[model samples]
Target: MCQRCEEPERPEEERYLIEVLDQIRENGWCVQGVLGTGSRPSWAYTAGLTAQGLPELVVTGLLPHHAARLLNAAAEQTLHTGPPVPGEQWLLPRLPKLEIVQLSAPAAHLHIAVCCYGAGIEARQLVYADSAGRFPWSPQYNSGRGGQPVLGVRHA
Candidate 1:
């Protein structure tokens, strides 16, 4: 969503945070979500990528702990049935020095505002398991969506 479309509607604090994130990204900083330390790691899937090639990490309708482990190698998290679970992580590996920002709106349980840092391994953040099928990637979504390049579709 564009800043104008999603920003003004946000609460004051949230609006401010979005603005800051905009600035940070503008300054060439990369921001993405990460799993929290000490908390139990949750199940996640990397469904696909945006038209821009950003990976869509889905994290819902997921199998339980054991089931998830058995299927951990899969990228598509949910079956095409069931209620949609909304959670996701937008990875920006193109830009290094990654970090996570927990907006007032909860992001699949991972959070922000602390500036916590350490360890060399990248943190595993998450997003909606259902969102794996969202626009820019899913062919069904590419139809008539006029924002980003609909990868497989040709312009008239």
Candidate 2:
């Protein structure tokens, strides 16, 4: 299940909510609840962001096989490894010092950041909720001799 976090003041917000629910249904993830009660006051969503800054794909009562399949998919998409570019910077804090790489001609410039928690495990998974809109950007560093710091648009 995926949560679409939002303030509910905009038209697109409402539309996105509908789409999220529809996608959950299509994915076969059960609908948990709209609002959360008890200790937390916010609406309860099947999927949501944890206190840590990572996306949560909440799954409840799934068979072991299904759970394994989902987890396997997540594991497969770990950061793509490459060398650091001459002047690119990595902004994702939780991620390990970035290994930037520069591509050849014809290809658009590419910047990749890998989470450096462990051998390959991410310390925390980034949560992407519908209501939340989007996650904050990671701060990046310029890679010049006296590289300037380029703050990411998103906060830590």
The lDDT leader among the candidates is 1
**TM-score of model 1 vs. true structure:** 0.20
**Which clashing pairs does model 1 show?**
59-129, 60-129, 87-127, 87-128, 88-126, 88-127, 88-128, 89-127, 102-112
Q: For candidate 1, which ten residues in a row score worst on lDDT?
A: 95-104
C-alpha lDDT of residue 39 in model 2: 39
Cα lDDT tens digits for candidate 2, 14-40 = 565566546544653222332323433
Residue 19, model 1: Cα distance from true site in angstroms: 2.9
| Candidate 2 residue runs with Cα over 4 Å from true position | 1-10, 29-72, 75-156
Residue runs of model 1 more than 4 Å from their true location after superposition: 1-13, 24-29, 33-38, 41-53, 56-156
**TM-score (all chains, Cα) for each model:** 0.20, 0.20
lDDT of 1 by residue, 35-127 (tens): 423333333322212211223222322235522332232222222222122233333222111112222222332232222111111222232
- Give lDDT per model, in order: 0.30, 0.27
